[model samples]
Target: MILIVVGVIMIVTSLVSTVTTNYKKLQLQPTTESPGRDDWHHFSTGSYKLFPTEVNYEAAKNGCRNANARLVTEGIRNKVTRKSIMDEMILPAFNANKLGEGYGVWIGLDDLEVINKWKWIDGIASTNDNTAWAPSEPNNGSERCGMLHKLLKWLINDEYCLVANAYVCEIAKSK
Candidate 1:
């Protein structure tokens, strides 16, 4: 009797795990089938249209800084900007890479060097405080890089800073 109960519990647990993972992966709408031209691969940061390069979090941030810019952070919760990101940033990267290609991109926010405190490379915190994951995000589990997960909605991760992947760089607008 005990053995049978244990087996049934295990089966149920496995099924639940599988269901949750699948649900997360299905959150995003599908990416574009045909990747357009290079110019169409990215979105605008203020007045400057920025492009992404394959690199880790730290390097990408540094690279952007060298050019007096910063990494792209999707802290915007507006409809227009969201649509552009869906069309430009997300779709292009999906088509150009693997299913979850380009896991590491320097966004405008991270708590790698710090903990719980996430700010953009530009030193500005997200004005929209609602752009957070489901309560207990950032896992902070030895992970030091941040990426917008393919599924899991606003779920973000922190992995090693040196881990290279595709990243979005942001340049400041001329006032």
Candidate 2:
């Protein structure tokens, strides 16, 4: 009976020690990660921040690439999502610049690769359900680029890729 108790005690003690060791190891693991910049901001929809500086489409894309991000691409789809992105991301910048209704901002979408076949730079699939084109937009023009046309109530429209315009850059927040 004493032997059985001793064996049971030994087993329990072994389990306790193992559990304690594992707990300590887990505690030593890093719990918090930092992205290193406080100026970066995000909206509640999927947590991505926009760079408000204006530039032409190519230059803006290059700028975003330099910053380890890409031009804004994730939010504009249906009218609701488009409005959300415009209100949350583009409108604030426009308000800050005191820009007029005719102004536009370059987005990460373009049909440059194939006419009328728009694609986001982030590789998000383009579908009828995921499009927010203004009526008569993607209008088969030589522009071959997409922008959030403020005059059209912040809807997506094709514009000249080389046109100098304010752009939004999207940086995904690290988990």
For 29-125, candidate 2 gives per-residue lDDT tens digits of 9865545435555554334445555567899789867766677776554354456667766678687874433358777888777777778887776
Tell me which residue pairs clash in candidate 2: none
lDDT of 1 by residue, 18-131 (tens): 999998888765766434323433334342223456676777777766655566654233345545665566556566763244553445566655766666555566443534
Clashes of 2: 0
Residue 79, model 2, lDDT = 52
By summed lDDT, the worst window of 10 consecutive residues in model 2 runs over 40-49
Clashing pairs in 1: 55-165, 56-164, 73-108, 108-120, 143-158, 144-158, 144-159, 145-158, 145-159
Model 2 TM: 0.67
lDDT of each: 0.55, 0.71
Q: Residue 106 CA error for candidate 1 (Å)? A: 2.6
